[model samples]
Target: MELRWNPILETWVMVSAQRQRRPFMPKESCPFCPGSGKVPDQYDVYLYPNDFPHLMKDPPEPSIQDDDLLRVERAFGSCDVVLYSPDHTASITQLSREHLARLFELWRDHYRAMRERADVKYVLIFENKGDIIGVTIPHPHGQIYSYPYIPARPAKELDSARRYWESHGGACLFCAVLQKELAFEKRLIWTNEHFVAFLPSYADYPNEAHIYPRRHCGSLLDMSKAEAEDFMDGLQRQVRIYDSLFGFELPFMMGFHQEPVDGAEYPYFHFHVEFYPLHRSRDKIKYNAGSETSGGAFTNPSSPEENAEELRKINAEL
Candidate 1:
């Protein structure tokens, strides 16, 4: 496990061959179950260290020595899995709102724990659902990764937000985005008192949705008790819409975007959750092919308004 520097792209690529040897366990032998002997005998929610983590506290030296072009360093970080329920069949949508709020609290505490580490630069909380999304474990759960350095996508967002702040007299770029979405209103799917779920106008996927806090906040720690409850409500509704979209469990990738924990100032940064579902429609699946993977260009065949309207109709029924 080591970090290889990509000079052309200016990013650190994690090289962990151990992940290739991960064991795939079926539901009958699932380790995340209550009686599986891998976790506590009984618990509402559990936190288990990843058996095959991409990063760790003590990693071996790099495979190849450092050269003028190729730079290498140890992969020093941690990854852990947050099991949502001991019952093997309960999805996030089925979990009560109170349970989801507890999950959110667990994420916040874990983020705070990782932030205390001087080497940790970013803490990412994300979930992958459905077998098509590469989740072999059928159990409902999420994962947290503490990175030694900020990942590329979040770094780009921070850079853009910072530039916008500096140029616009400390105006926040994300807040501006939320306001624009609210003004358009066509892309909004659902909303509570404290949060809004909408498809961005610049969406790259057909059903891509984002949840943003109505009040400007940098991280989960900034959420009040009311905001926390409302956030979970928004999240649950978002997934409910996903499942109802095609009368089947839809596969999707959900991630939290927040300010870095490097102890620097990022007043312009905002907290949001982005969902990238693999389904383009009830019958079609959206795959990242040549344009997306090779050239970094995401092509959306459908308009965000039409897509959001579809979800809004579902929201109305729910």
Candidate 2:
């Protein structure tokens, strides 16, 4: 089994065809099962390395630091699944604000701890909801992965921000985007003093939406407690809109972008959360297909402006 790294897209795609042979189970092996050796009820939070990893765990350390054309390494990182609730059936949307707030607090603590390690340079916190995204567990939870180097996507975003700062004399690029979108009022969904949720004009999905802060901030750790609360409120509201759009609980993969742990300033980087749902129509699904998978471009069936309009109307009616 070999994983091919596509330099064109800067994405490492696993080409292990044998993985398809893995058995399918009708029921999820609930990781949060009570008194189970893998998951205990006493743990509100826990961090550990992934039992199964695409990257090897014992690769040479110097290989990662090498700047040569060829690099190698053991997966000098960690992947920990977060158990968000004692009830396996509950999702974040169904969780109380208090539990969500504590989860946010735990996120901060995890990010800070991971950043302190010399080997780790980026902390990724994300959730993959629904079976469409291949979430093995039906339980409400997310995962935290600490990497030894910045991933390609974040690296690209950081470079984009840096270039924009250099060209615009330190003005934040996303701030400008938010300002212009708010003025346009076309793709705008809902916004408050602290955060704004909108569908971008260049959205690649039928109803993709993003939640970003009004003020420029490098990371979630930079946000004050009140600001974090506002973010959580905004997150819940945006998700509710998504659910309302289809009249069903929407499924999405949500992730956050924050400053790198390499100690470089990213003044132009504004923290945001993005959600990508696979559904395009009420009952139909959108496939990435050849164009998206090979061409690295997307063809959306609906316009962002229209999606925003519909979402806003639905939310208002709700």
Candidate 1 — worst ten consecutive residues by lDDT sum?
A: 19-28
lDDT of 2 at 65: 43
Q: Where is the poorest 10-residue window by lDDT in model 2?
A: 59-68
What value does the lDDT take at residue 164 in candidate 1? 98
**Superposed Cα deviation of residue 77, candidate 2 (Å):** 1.1
lDDT of 1 by residue, 1-318 (tens): 889999999999998888898877865799998777899998888889999987888878888898878889988889999999988889888888778888988999999988898878999999999888889798889999999999999999999999999999999999999999999999999988999999999998888999999999999999999999999888888999999999998999999998888999889999999999988888888999999999999999899999999999999999
Model 2 per-residue lDDT tens digits across residues 113-171:
87777767777888888888887667677887676678888888888988998999888
| Top-scoring candidate (lDDT) | 1
| TM accuracy, model 1 | 0.98
Q: List pairs with backbone clashes in candidate 2.
A: 56-75, 59-73, 59-74
Candidate 1 total steric clashes: 0
Model 2, C-alpha of 152: deviation from truth (Å): 2.1
Count clashes in each candidate, considering only residues at least 3 apart in sequence or on different chains.
0, 3
Candidate 2 local Cα displacement, residue 166, angstroms: 0.6
